[model samples]
Target: METKKLLKAAAGAMIVAFAISACQTKKTATGQNADPAHNSMNSVDWAGTYQGTLPCADCPGIRYTITLKDDDTYVLKTRYLEKGDSVFTESGTFAWDENGGKITLADRGEKFQVGENKLFHLDMEGNRITGSLAEHYVLTKMTDQITDRYWKLIEVGGQAVADGSTQKEPYIQLNSEGNRVEATGGCNGMGGTYELKEPNRISFSQLIGTLMACENMEVENGLKRALESADSYHVQGDTLQLFRARMAPLAKFVAKGK
Candidate 1:
């Protein structure tokens, strides 16, 4: 009877040891105690165009347009309004911070915290700005499409292009089919080929327009000049702005009907 009791106790001990070992193996395989990592780089849909007007001391404001791509590259453009017609543009790869919450521009050393549909500008030390001006440092994402729509010229070189000033309101249409661009500069019909080299970079070529001249050719002349000089563009909601380098927009347009 004593031998049988000892045998039973030994079997029980073996079963308990096997069960504890299996439990530990399961925990290790499933990673039950590990914490999952989450950050803006993995959680946010951050690759897109962002734009805002930052405060400036000597000028009205600094217009900023930045484009971040999925390939870890970026394009940054800035214009100091009321200062001069010069747009500063920079492009290069960007690096994510250790925690993957922020990005530092490779060329400018500028840092921005990635957020949902926006970016928060950080100071040189990588801290968010404080006080009343903090709100002005945000850059909102732009999701509007720039092609296959009628863009009516609203302002040209800081001057408003009034409706009915010409036979046909000045407008441009970018067709995605053949990369063709068709326009009417308030009076004459114009056709050209346009190429979008990068996210915001654009160039117009093979431009040919009607030879007829109107009495007031101011709008037409300005529109043509804007098209020829524009090397970059910005789209915010229904508005489209064409720019050269980092200067102010040479021309601004609004989408008409859908």
Candidate 2:
């Protein structure tokens, strides 16, 4: 009877030991199997809005905003600054490369690279993007609530267009309300009304302004032409580009504030 009891105790101890060994082995295997995906997610948390500024050879610094979607997709919007003008915004998309620990952005046929800790830098990470950077964060995943904002222009192409052609000098200004428009003809301030159209379009009409005589008239001539010839408008980044139904290239403006 004693021998049988001892044999039963030994068997129970062996079973418990085997169970412990199996569990340890499973844990080790799991850790080893976690490759790029685990490392990528561990590095950058790309769930919010990202904004930054990068240098461009043709312009000042270009600012950008990137929104990550819940579905693992992303939208990238950027701005290009011109000399003495508002910035221009260019938008596109991107994807996460888990194993590579970097986000692969769509460059519209432009080449981009991704690597661990080698991503472009960014400014603040929040609802409002502010600051400058040379690199963007490498995205790992995206959510659905990413696309929510639309950009508006306070000034027409790089310069403002006035209503009259008689001023001495041509100059532009966005009224204080930012809703009204006006400009300096060579001699006086011209005024006008404008509207935002559908699907990234804008128009100006019911235009009227004051006439005056001044020393300079070149700007007055151009301002008068811009107002009469203006047909359509589009806003990108801080830069605004105007169009004239196959007549001319129109005017371009940057955002009012820096």
Candidate 3:
């Protein structure tokens, strides 16, 4: 009877030891105590500013600035010169890839590819995105103040200038208050009265201005003709770029400083 009891006790101890060893082995293999949110691909953080120059022959080279946000949204800013005048700002929204490797822009309601790195291509998935790593470009995430200061271009349609020589000298000048804009000829500056129709559009009706001659009356005449031909104006940054449907390139101007 004593031998049997000792044998039973030894068997129980062996079983318990084997069970503990098996649990430790399982824990070692699975890392059960490790962090639940940890990921292996959090190496690249693409939440910042990326800037570059875009090539254009007819106008000054376009300056590009893109800002990314922590929530994965983005904005793009472009500056370019046109017909001896310069436009300083043009902007739109942006999107990013899962691993933070690529970015895209909402170019006229479509998601367009926009990262400097070619490793990952910016592609859209319905409303989501997928892409690879970027190189040679900086991605700066957006902040409150940054968003507040963002400049957007207000697109006004194009117009046709009158047929007289005086009508060809259309020039615009900002009022001392900056609230009103007056132009000379094209026809008359008084005919052009500015109306802030919508948040993104500036309308000019009955545009009129005084008739004057400058050093280069011919060039001034051409400028006036261009301005008179403008059916709409877009104000971006500290500059405005004018567009005409039939014209190949756009016109640009700097905003009057306060």
Candidate 4:
């Protein structure tokens, strides 16, 4: 009877030890504690501009540049080396693969594997490279956001803004300090505070404009409506595009200074 009691106690102690060890075990990709979820990538993680000098069959090389915006849209710019000054540009949407480790261009179905500040040119079959030229197929990221500068209103709802040929053009200045937004509301002097809610999300509030109504009231009204409706923004090269909640751009601005 005493031996039986001892056996029970020993079994209880063994169970306790096992439980403690299990509690300390960390989950790994192949471990018993691993999670079933896979392929998690947010907009900020996948959005950026990537560039590389890709090999070409006819030309010396192709300077490949692709801008990945948070809106799932992408712009592909390519320049043929030793060919001409002509630049080929294409813009469309992109989708992530099942693993989230790759993105497929919607227009051409080309696949690119995502990595740390790099994108690998993958085969159409969406597999990793195993050849001598594998190293050269990688593109490095140039940064996703642009620096703050004086941005002049260039386009309003897809129409090109006049270059002050007749009237003075509208302009805006975004100060890095305190999220202040100052601009010419096409006809009046405007000032406001902006909120950068996220990498892609932005909001403007407390906007006030002068009452000195100018001749171009239509332009002024358009600018005010666009600014108030803007909920997101994207900076591509020298251009800044303001968008309103899942819709097309409300306004587009270009940096005036070098």
Q: Which residue runs of candidate 3 sit more than 4 Å off their true CA positions?
A: 1-41, 82-92, 98-100, 108-258
Minimal lDDT window, size 10, model 4: 27-36
The TM-score leader among the candidates is 1
lDDT (Cα, tens digit) per residue for candidate 1, span 39-114: 7888889987898999999888999888888999887878898877677777789999877788999968999999
Report every candidate's CA lDDT.
0.87, 0.49, 0.44, 0.75
Residue 251 shift from truth in candidate 4, angstroms: 22
After superposing candidate 2 on the true structure, give the runs of residues whose Cα lies further than 4 Å from its correct spot: 1-179
Clashes of each: 5, 28, 31, 0
In model 1, which range of ten residues has the least summed lDDT?
28-37
Model 4 Cα shift for residue 185 (angstroms): 10
Maximum-lDDT candidate: 1
lDDT of 4 by residue, 1-258 (tens): 999999999999999999887776743432345332543344326566788888789988888878777788887878888887666778899897655667899969998887777888988898767688788788888764432467888777767777762245687776534458888856678999876533578888999988885676666677788889999899886788899976888888887763
Write model 3 residue lDDT over 1-258, tens digit each, in one string: 999999999999999999999998888555454333432224434455555554457765655555555665655555664544232343555654343333455664434333332122223442323233233222233221111221221222232333343433444554312235554433333334443322233444554446654342443444445545655555544665654553542444444322
TM-score of each model, in listed order = 0.49, 0.32, 0.27, 0.46
| Candidate 3 lDDT score relative to the true structure | 0.44
- Comparing candidate 1 with candidate 4, which one achieves the higher TM-score? 1
lDDT of 3 at 47: 51
